[model samples]
Target: MTKNIKANGLNHLAISTNNMKEQIEFYTDVLGFRLVALYWMHGVEGCWHGFLEMNDSSQVAFVFNPANKDAKVEYGVTNPGHTGGPSAPGTMQHLAFNVDTLDDLLNMRDRIRSRGYNVMGPMDHGMCHSIYFQGPEDTCLEVATFGNADYPIGPKDWIDPEVQELAGISDEELAKFTNPIEFEGQGGTIPNPGYNPDSYNPDRPVQLLQGMFAMPDEQFAMIPMEKRPPSMMSDEDRAAKHAN
Candidate 1:
């Protein structure tokens, strides 16, 4: 009998960087991730590793190879003789994250700015507003907030055309439009494109944890539970636990 199979979600994403210290600073100080672990690997000369955890305990690892002494190497540069070598816009373009509120998104933008990094505005997407910044590793990152979850903004399709004409559509305005195809029953007069009326439901919360490295499933299975650190808990809960 197949044992009751419960699939666990993503544990973390790993990325190799030339400057580990900068990367750690960017993720921890600028992005608010907590540095959970750090260590050096044996038999791997000049290599170090660090792990960071988000508020939800989602983990990201950064591996540093100091032996690779090329400081000026940009992301797109590749070894000439190798075929299909590394490229800047390789398979992944960027990573996107969701925030709980518009204020949260703005606060993040401010935090990123405080680090002296240039960040793109809280641009409005059809269903969300986002801000973009480059991590210390030069990886493009985005933080977005679903318009429906915060603020008095209504769905995009529900907004009257006349109102749009009068107000002048901005990124903020566009981000307010929820996919009418997704959320249909909120009672605003948006035209439904034959979406399953009975099956229509509000969007559920989702967290996306993405990374550059892929580990073998067997290796993951071999990891002991005790070795895996507990996830990040809320400040109040953590204080209570410490008091106990």
Candidate 2:
């Protein structure tokens, strides 16, 4: 028997920031996002974290550290600078936020322009209409709304066989990609497969990876999650101190 599980929506997108205050102002004043959280990161030393409310559950978080301030920003490596530009392989090229309606998207564009930032367009992409703009630190931003909410957009309408072949994906692979294999509940019966370099590639040292893999799941989980630094402030205290 197989079990069905999937992510519902994005909870948050954490972006590394050099200046927490500047990013906070840009996100709150220019983009109309409400500042929700600002405090020292729980586990990391000298690291400040800020969160802006996108919705009740989701937020856009910022992390600032002294080291991050000194880090150099290479246009094509650190950021794309503009929408449709190139960035490093693993780096975020651009971020797009969703709007409920086309009118809302246009209103966002107007609001951004009012904040003295130039916006690109409400361009139609067949499935959605988007307006592009720039954010602080060369961050490419976009707000979009679906062209037709009544119509369901599926892979059939968007996936092209030619592009699929160009990506070296066979028919069988494409089928599996579209419809993923279901996982059956194992009731914690399955053991760790152990470190196989071919199966898992991590940037960490071999010794570190092996030791980490050998550690018990309970111990490993607490290393990152359960840490409460001495200087850590409660969410309530932090929010009250920086009341907006």
Candidate 3:
């Protein structure tokens, strides 16, 4: 029998940024999200992480790395440039956040415009109405509100057969994709099957990768636990760091 486990919703969504301060301002000041956590990213050198609260449990996080400043952004490659455009495969084409109602969506649109940024949409997309805008560092932002229906989105009705054919998904493949099988529990019976160099490929050097795979999971967990939160740091400790 499959274990009774499922993921309910998002805990947070992390986006990489070169300018943490600018991203923080856009999320908090303009979008009215509360600043919750700001600290030096654990296990990473010279990186800063900030979180803007989306709800009590979920947040929108940004990571700032100095190396990103040297990276170039080519529209349609780095970013789509708008809500509907092309981006490199595996990249986040756009991020759409959820709101409760149409009124809330419009109010957010007004708030963004008041901050001197142009927003497009309040355009209806059948199941939801959305507003599109640009954020710092060519980030495409969207806010949407689902319609007040018993089942706001019907996947069966929404999935087009022609589009499915174009994507080369057969009936069996579509059924499997839509409804995935639940995993049976192993009850901690699996052994560490130590790393294999031939089977695995890493972008970084094998020596560096081997060192990481060699460490016990329990020992690695302590590395992040050593760093305290930004708010808890003392004056002398604060001087050694930079986070806004």
Candidate 4:
């Protein structure tokens, strides 16, 4: 049987940084994100990791590998910055951060330009107003703002039925996708998937943290209930558990 799960919001997005210092400076100084934490990556040798907090739940994290110092990025492939293009499969194409208002989006455009970046558009993208720019490591970035859920940021007429048909979405399927049936939480333990990896789509992650995906079904179930990601643990509790 299929299970229903609800996710509140993004926790963070982690990306590899060729130059951690440059990434940190760009995000913290230029973009106005507060540097929350910088620490050695646990269990990894000669690596550094840090977080730039957008808010309590949202963050942009960077992982620096000194071992790959001389590696070259293939622009438009590995790195799709500079007015945006395409990236290799399994590579992150671009990242968009949310702003609260259209005024905020316009101000962000001015902010980017003031920093000497060739920023483009508060483009009217139907769903949101967005500004695009390039950042360190050829990372394509966008800032966007949308109206409240009750209001239509996009006109109903803007939705093209032909495109929907071309995408092979039937009216019923589209209805279901847009207005999904909400599932009430059981408020119990995470259920064992009881499935084989061979039957799963490798690209579709059932669960993820940062950029990492869920463990193998059997291995995931073996984890003690208290050690699960959702289980709350204090510093002392974690220390005691680790010492066990």
Quantify all predictions' global Cα lDDT against the true fold: 0.63, 0.82, 0.83, 0.74
User: Per-prediction TM-score, please?
Assistant: 0.50, 0.84, 0.84, 0.70
Between candidates 2 and 4, the lDDT winner: 2
- The runs of at least 3 residues in candidate 4 whose Cα sits more than 4 Å from the true structure, single-residue gaps closed, are 1-5, 43-46, 66-71, 82-84, 147-151, 154-159, 199-244
lDDT of 1 by residue, 86-177 (tens): 55443335666667878999988898898898888787665678887666545667888885443445554457767777888865556654
RMSD of each: 15.8, 5.0, 3.6, 7.0
Instruction: Report the CA-based lDDT of candidate 2 relative to the real structure.
Output: 0.82
The number of the candidate with the highest lDDT is 3
Cα lDDT tens digits, model 3, 1-244, are: 5575568689988888988888888888988899998887876778878999989988999988889888789887888888789999967899988889989999989999999999998988778899999988889989999955344686677788999999999999999888877766577555456567777556788787777777776776676343667667798766655342
> Which pairs clash in the backbone of model 2?
none
Report the lDDT tens digits of candidate 4 across residue range 1-244.
5566678798888899878889988998678899887765654656768899999889999998886677678876777655557778778888998889887877888877888888888787666777888888778888888742234554254557899899999989888877789786676546545435565445545454312333454664575544233145567876765565
lDDT by residue (74-175, candidate 2, tens digit) is 888888878888889989889899888888888888889998999988888878888888888888998888855444467878788999989999999989
User: Which residue runs of candidate 1 sit more than 4 Å off their true CA positions?
Assistant: 1-9, 41-46, 70-92, 147-244
Q: Rank the candidates by lDDT, best first.
A: 3, 2, 4, 1
